[model samples]
Target: MIPGQGGIVTRFAPSPTGRLHLGHAASAIRAHDFAVTRGGRFLLRIEDIDGTRSRPEHVAAILADLAWLGLRWEGPVFQSQRLDLYAEALAKLDAMGLVYRCYCTRAAIAASLSAPHGPEAVYPGICRNRPRHEDTDAPHCWRLDVAKALARTGPLNWWDETAGTIACEAAAQGDVVLARKDAPSSYHLAVTVDDAAQGVTDVVRGIDLFAATHIHRLLQALLAVPTPRYRHHPLLTGPNGERLAKRHGAPTLAALREAGEDGRALADLLRAGRLPTGFSARNA
Candidate 1:
């Protein structure tokens, strides 16, 4: 689906691994506003792909938090319930010779690297040519052969609200894992598939995920999914200029509400680009 073709459709997909923080609030409010302002549909998707870390309490808290902020969504889809859809997408990629089994563990990959690299380091393609086991029970994750996939799709680009038309550089991310050994799908595969299935015309998310859009674009081409317009807004940061995160001790929305903060008021402030004391929006 394309934006402006059949109205705009956006979503706020959050993982249920932790409580919703201010950063998440900023993102949700932006997405909600973008859809509501355009008479479009807003969706809430529970990214509970990591079954081990996802909690039912967190999911409930997310719903309660969004509602408290005066944001209403059409349907709260759960990634856990859409395993079959992800499997079918992966099968299509596998049939195209773009999917391969990767048996490298985190430790193994780290040890194999000659030097330290950025957090989003390119996967060294250690298992790209490994012999595929006929046994389905083998403990291995599926990774996309980025080089081969790019060869099929050739040069590509996507439209972004802020960046205009941007060239895709999927190869920079290397071969991304599509499905984990213990999970049905990875974030790249699941989000790409879900967006198309949900008919999302516009993808509103944080600027931190800007790089991942390259891989998503490539996946869309490989899976033949419709690409949506991207709007990656700025992220909320603390007094130290660091991004708000659970690990950084950012207060959760539940805690803010418990402290007598007005949810609607907070939402309004965020929508107006007026953040609370010691909080700022990081566009870069």
Candidate 2:
């Protein structure tokens, strides 16, 4: 059943894999303000589906960071605590004939001579038709057969507050993994389930996740969940024109706090759509 039948809701769900950085701050503030200004609910969901990378300390720091930014949220739900929910959703998808087992590894996909399809090495159905066996223990993942899934859901599209109407081009992503060997649900599946559970009506995030929304919209239809209104805001980039990332050594909000940076002031600058030195915002 679709949620969001009540008041508007928004969320800032971040995986507790690393410290919250400026990029994280910008997204959180926008989501929180959107809900609050509309007299709606703002929720915080810990996207700790990655059991391997998520850390407890990181979650704590995330709350602290958001609070310092003058943003408040309700029910900081932990994905680790919602495993059953995700599993149930996965089971529903599996029952539908649109799911399949994929045994291809990243190395194999990269080494394939199929040539890169797009920005991401979209899986080229390496194991879509591979013979399935009863006893073989090869590591495998559950992928959504985009073609079959679309057939079930039909042509779909989602509204982007910034980019306007956009059709679902999930085929460009090929068959995306819904469940990984290490995680019960991938980002696309988990977020779709979580947002519906939380009754999220509006989603404000970075443009970097724009393509994934296509997959999410399709999943929402397949799962019979409500599709939230999306606002893919510009990403905070460094002076070098690269997206701010943990690997790039983006300074954590905690680090900036320790360095005596005024949290509220920084948040104000972000609200005003301004950036500090050596940083800028770019849209996709």
Top candidate, metric lDDT: 1
| Candidate 1 per-residue C-alpha lDDT over 173-243 given as tens digits, one digit per residue, 9 for 90 to 100 | 89999999889999999999999999999999999899999999999999898999999888888889888
TM-score of each: 0.95, 0.93
Which ranges of candidate 2 are over 4 A from the true structure? 1-6, 116-119, 131-135
Question: How far off is residue 70 in model 2, in Å?
Answer: 1.1
Poorly placed runs, candidate 1 (over 4 Å): 1-6, 133-136
Error of model 1, residue 114, in angstroms: 1.0
Q: What are the root-mean-square deviations of the candidates from the true structure over C-alphas?
A: 2.6, 3.1
Worst lDDT run of 10 residues, candidate 2, spans 1-10
Clashing pairs in 1: none
lDDT per residue as tens, model 2, 185-267: 88888899999988899999999899899999999999999989999998899988888988887899999988988999999
